[model samples]
Target: MVNTISHIHCQNCSMAPLCLPKNLSEGDMARLDTIIQRHKPLHKKDLLVTADAPLRYLYAVRSGSLKSYTLDDHGVEQIIDFHLPGDLVGFDALATGRHRSFTQALETTMLCEIPLNSLDDLSAEMPVLRRELMSMMSSELYTSKQLLGSLNNRAADARLAHFLLGLSQRFADRGLSGKSFRLSMTRADIGNYIGLSVETISRILSRLQHENVLLVENKLVEILAMDRLERLAG
Candidate 1:
């Protein structure tokens, strides 16, 4: 079920605050709206962008979630990142002009496609767009470093805790409930991202629930004790 809306304005987009046009002026936003093309809903496991494909547009996730991954020599998929609503994907191709990883929908997803060629002209006229793009790239780099550090951790519990805490903060940034949210990724996906086995991920979650630090019901998770979770993450 895809819903494509024509003539949508960034100034009125619910995700504007967390998107590229967060601080853009009204005039700039109108100009931006001209270049954005809203896509229909992508069903689960649909590829938004394929690895090695030529990059044409940057995608702003409007709703639902997506995952970026790459396959190893043995054909094992190495999950790299989870993109939530308000996250931008395809920036990795800015320098190379080709996507390095596959981006696939984790569930039903909607996005706004920003033509990359339009950005140069737009940025030249509106300096704020350039600065915002740079800021967003820097933030993405920082997140990559953080994920690298998390992957190096030997403790399974710590990695799991860190992952949950990270998601909580991200959800909070989107003006959503930080204490409770449904996880779009499955336990197997979580294990692959955090360098743990699926059984280990289940064990750690069970332990957290046993300690009353979290409450997990299927995919829905509620952090009952944020302070405890933070300590565990550390």
Candidate 2:
């Protein structure tokens, strides 16, 4: 069972800058808000959507995190990407009209739901919104490409460093502390996403901690040496 969160308009959302266009007029923003549906919080491991489901709405991560994944022919889960606040989901369904991967909550999460049909009609009247949506889709594509590049031909330790730094920057972009945060996903999920083994992930993390570059205790991580971590990532 799911429970709903309180209403918060787009104009008042702190993530508006990251999730919405900067130039939207008051009227446009209000119109967009009207089309949004707020959902109850999702608990840890709850499936938000499953593969091949019809695409009814796109989701904006209001808080917490989610992981998108699909199973391989051998029945292995292939983790695609982990989404954070300000990130959008459901783009994977746009081309086929059905979801291509399973999306689930990594922890308790809040999301803003935007109906696709209503958004289509609204975007037709609001060029700004249309453009912003297109920009977001394009940005998603670019991030996917960057992830592929990061995974290719990179050493295991370098890959881990790069992944951590990427998360750090993403958190900072959301006006949160970049140097410390919780790892919403498990080590195995990180390994699967970055093309490393679970053991490799733990070993790399331990090595980093030993080097005083980061302090890791359970899921909590603190960057003790940002400069050194950046150098390692490079």
Candidate 3:
């Protein structure tokens, strides 16, 4: 059965600092809470939104991770981005009112959905939320640029190192351990995101492990030498 959660007050939400309600007044927090719809855990691989679907709400990852990807003309899946807890999804729909990619849970995930219309209406009364949304969108754009830069004329090892380092920093931002973490996405998904074949990704991981730079067993990654990884990323 699909699980659903009852709405909760924004002031009590752990994700408020990382979400649109960051720095909001108590009055604004209460107003923001009214528009949020909470969901129970979504099993891994369950789609939260699909490409071309009508856009109604923006989803915030309250827990776990998700991936956003799209299929090309030849039907090959191209991963666009991975969303961690506290990251916002569905902003790509803002321009066209339809999703441009599919967002799927990478693990059992919980989300808080913010109705777009209600958010806009509430934003007028709570300007801080509006500014927060803009800031979040800008941050997404910057991340996209970084992705593009990473994909351009870079070695496979460098790309992988960069990706790992990036993930580490993102986790640290969420108050999670940066040195040790599990990868929610598989090797193939990582390969797709980094523009490499699965075999190549495996080889790179093996090399890193041999060099004592990382400890990778299945999806779990322990960064044994972050300084070395950063230098390799450079």
lDDT of 2 by residue, 1-234 (tens): 333255577888888888954569888999999999887789999999999999999999988999999997898999998999888899999999999999999999989999999999999999999999999899889888988888888889989999999999999999999999999999999999999999998998999999899999999999999999899888
Clashes of each: 0, 2, 0
lDDT per residue (tens digit) for residues 7-38 in model 1: 45587778899999998988888888888988
lDDT of 3 by residue, 1-234 (tens): 343266455687777788888888888888888889887678999999999999999999888999999999998899999999889999999999999999999999988888999999988877789899999999999999998999899999999999999999998988889999999999999999989999999999999999999999888999999999999999
Cα-based lDDT at residue 29, candidate 1: 87
lDDT of each: 0.91, 0.91, 0.91
Runs off by more than 4 Å, candidate 1: 1-4
Report lDDT (Cα) of residue 88, candidate 1.
93
Worst 10 residues of 3 by lDDT: 1-10
Alpha-carbon runs more than 4 Å astray in model 3 = 1-4
Clashing residue pairs in candidate 3 are none
Root-mean-square deviation per candidate: 1.3, 1.8, 1.7
